[model samples]
Target: MQTINLLLAGFQSAFELAAFITVVVGLLVGVIAGALPGISFVNAMAMALPFTYAMGATQAMLFLGGIYVGGVFGGSISAIMINVPGTPASLPSTWDGYAMTRKGQVKRALTIAVTASATGGLVSALMLTFLSAPFASFAMRFSQPEFFAATVLGLVSVIAIAKDKPIITLISLLIGMAIGTVGVDPLYGQARFSFGIPEVESGIRFVVVMIGLFAIGEVVDLVASNRDLRPKKTDGKPERVRLRDILAVKGAILRGTGIGCMIGVIPGAGATPGAVIAYGVEKQINPRGAEFGTGVEAGLAAPEAAKNATTGAAMVPLLTLGIPGSAATAIMLAAMMLQGVNPGPLLFIMDPSMVYTIFAAMIIANVLMIGAGFGVAQMFSTLMRTPPAILAAFIVVLSLIGAYGVRNNIFDVYVCLVFGVLGWAMKRVGFPSAPLVLGVILGPLAERYFLTAVANSRQDYSVFFTRPISATILFIAFVFVLWSLWPTLKSRIGRQPA
Candidate 1:
């Protein structure tokens, strides 16, 4: 009871006038950055970090945390309206969100998005506030063997629920694992895939690869699609959406939140896998989920909840183990470090107030998003009213600016244009771009673990399976891989079902 009382009191303490003002400004900045294609949450935080130098740690945390939460929810607005996801996390929202737009229920879809996002974000924040210490304690007790086991469990579990083609998913996972090997081996200094290039020795920059696969690849893929093949003019009217329909997607909301929270616990795995797994689970559990491509609010609700829930859950890694989850969290972690705030177990003991403040700010941002998001989306909706010529030029310039802002480098700009074309072409051939992004993000982690396990066993192949946790995780991975290959193996023997 005392713990409960203290937590509620802590929430109240967040009402300082200064914190309130920071929340307001953060909301506005986050709204705009989130709606702008290619200007992801990470970039927004990085861009704003310079200004935060003047503020105290608590004050700066309020602004950064507020914007982080708001930006995530903000992506849903443009995703639903434009058929273009403002952030990678918004991809699943586009499945039904844009369909709802075509059904002329844009406003209603937006409302459902807001409601689900708020619910998920709020719940996750509360969970993080009260449960973080315990979770952090648990994470601290994990040894390398346990860590390896956990990592293996995640990959195997994720593969089980990935896209329709498990075989394809494994192939993608392996490709990622292989890419992870490109850098210097953690156990020994020898490089495997550097090809003797100095630039490659530091290894492929994870951020650069993400920028390429997600940001660049998406643009290329979208542009390659023949404009004529786009969905017809069934865009929904603002008023067509009903609260009843939003309420009906409750199952998706609940399922998505659970999945998002679970996945977010993994350091380096955040909303991307959460969204994909949520979408996949919704397909199995909800009747409407199977009808997703045909257009359904349930589909939108599931991904919206999953993606936004991850916003708060991703903080768990950063706060607990000083490890970042998603790329956005990576940038946030860096920003905090720049301000001289080290995030670790000691941070919890030494700066409880500052930690509580961030927790409070997270909740406040979700609340602010409800009102700020509506206005931002409505104003930006005027984009639909703009002529194609004007919009095209605007998109081009905006994309260029976004690419260059990553490092003010022209090389990235070329990468974006090239990937944009590639992405467009890939979609034409029925290939999904997400696997490519996942391949890039997970590539490194998989490689490090594999090499570490091998070295610990003195290059023995069985060392990875020696520990109880590691063995369990490896067994699961083996099962998952074989399960994915089952049908293919059967088909080769002429035993496939019709």
Candidate 2:
């Protein structure tokens, strides 16, 4: 009953003019960004982060929440229309969705994709609303040790998701953690990697690192490759979607949503894995599995549902434990911190109104995404017609400005530029940047929690293992790592000569 009342109050707050408009604007920005090849919604979020400073904490979350929800679905627009995935999570869409496009069923594919995405997101948002309070209650028992363990679990889960190339991912993650340690030590306040540079002592802001890595690198690549962004016209007449079309794939949508919700809450397994796994699972279980890649509606629906479903599920750990699961959520975390708001169990207790308002905004965003998706799909060609050079220049300027805006410091701009070049190089080499960004965001939190736990326990490291919750979480991390690597191990062993 209390939860019901709180949610009602939340809806009331979310319905306010400013919050409603913010969500609409953010949804538009996200859809446009996600539909454009090479310019992802994550990049759009990073660039938009600077603009959030003027918003209230609630409004900022509403804005970003709208973007997060809308962007996840927007990627499929391009994938279906042009055989190009605007975001990595949209990769599966290019297979079945583009197949549908080639068959002149592009409209049918889009209807299924958007409908499934909105439904999955709606279910996930409802889950976030009901499940978060209970999770927050559970999290109230967590101390520093448990928090540290949870952070570790988040870090290792990144490896699990990128299991195909764990070594490279780990190296990238470690490099990010090393970068995270460049400023004053969290506990001791002593600087280690400053190298006598005063600005360096304050540490590199993750926001700057994010913009440098995601935005600048992507822009440079688009410019250098000179890839044409326009969507090719399809030959088929647009098919009208009926309610029967949606009913036919209901099972796939539900299964994908379930899988996405489960994977999303794991802290590091994000939408990309969720989508891929859904596609894989749907292929195995659906009766038409053998026909998956040839414009099967179920195939397109499942991954689309899974990817958008992840948006709300990924927020579970962030709101309950303050652990960010992906780059997008990490940026949201940065926004919260910048607004002087700390997320976690106490956030629920201290600010239920704000928490529930975010929940309400998420629900509203998912509902509104249908309209936003169609609007952008219509304008996609016009958006693509903009010159790549002009777009690249605009992104570079925005990124540098975002970096400089961190502390209003020019040195941060230089740092951003340097990392931008590094990011471009890393991209060229096929190194994963997501894990590195996750490491930077989570590393400092882990350090802080670990040091505090040890210090509170008289410097005894065993305190982590002594506690049941912490130990259990660590054990889960261990098992998760083994589970993630087992396939590779098995394949390698099978390949060995007798």
Candidate 3:
């Protein structure tokens, strides 16, 4: 009853004209920014940080919360339609969502994606409203060792996507980890593999690398294949969403939401890992696991749901314990500090109204995201109607701009071009690049966490196994790896002569 009253009060405050408008505007900006390659929602939030100064505390949180919800889903727009993930979390979407686009089911793909995303985010928001306190306690239990174990789980889970090519996938992932190591040593603060170049010492930005690998390689493929992206005519009838289609993937959505909520509360494990882990889990469980990359609806829906579901759950640590779980939440923390608000258990008692109001805004944003997603998706899909050369040119220009904008350095542009060529070449040879990308994304986090855990534990290697949580997470990763590789092992056994 108390929770209900607090949430009701929250809804009342969020519905006020100023707050509502702020949310709507933020939602639109986030969706557009996320759909554009190179300009992620994190950058959008950073750019919008100045504008929040003009608004009251609650309104400011409302605006950024709306963007947080919308941006998580926005990346899927490009991933599904163009095979370029606007964010790392959307990489799994490209495997299945883009496959659907290739099969001329863009409308169906978008409908499923938006529906799953809204459902996941809505559930996450509700959980945030009611379970914040208990979940905060759970999140607090995670230390550096456990965090390192979670990162290892994320890295090992990539095996599910290897498709019987585990050796090659492992090699690709290792190469990515190598790339991630080029900047500075996390523990020593010394640069390695920079060859004394200033830009190399600054490290390669993953966003620039991501844009080059997916966007540039995709445009090259588009120009080379001469594939037409215009909507296909099907006896003068447009493909529509079926009730059965959503029903078919209901299990995936629920599972993804649960996984996302669990992962989000872990400080360093953000939406990217949540989405990828969801995809890997769905592949292992779904009956059509072998057909994951061929446009399976469950494949697309699970990750879409998982990524957006992380939005509200990601905020729990920030709101309850004054800990910023991810970069996005860190910005929110800055906004709160700028407003003279300190978030902690005391904030709930002292400023319950503001806290609950932000909760209400998250719910509203997720609900509103459905309409925003379709509106933006419709606009992006029209780009498919353009000639291949023009479309390719547009993608390349956007890719280049995104690369250069990473740090406003010409050297980053050169790195992106080098990666672009490598991506295209890898694509030509049918080598998996996603694992390499994952390696780059998680390797640094794993290294930082592992080093901190070890250093803090007096260089004790047994610290991981000594802790219950860390040991449990590492054990799970081990089981997951064996489970993922079981099919190949069984297949080889079947082919052996007696």
Residue 483 displacement (Å), model 2: 1.9
- lDDT scores for all predictions? 0.69, 0.80, 0.90
Q: Which 10 consecutive positions of candidate 1 have the poorest summed lDDT? A: 226-235
Span of 10 residues, lowest total lDDT, candidate 3: 227-236
Q: Which candidate would rank higher by TM-score, 2 or 3?
A: 3
Order of the predicted models by lDDT, top scorer first? 3, 2, 1
lDDT of 3 by residue, 355-385 (tens): 8999999999999999999999989977777
Off by over 4 Å in 2: 1-121, 128-133, 229-362, 373-381, 495-497
- The collision pairs in model 2 are none
Which of the predicted structures, 1 or 3, would earn the higher lDDT when compared with the native?
3
What TM-score, computed on C-alpha atoms, does each candidate reach? 0.81, 0.65, 0.98
Name the best candidate (by TM-score): 3
How much is the lDDT of residue 42 in candidate 2? Answer: 87
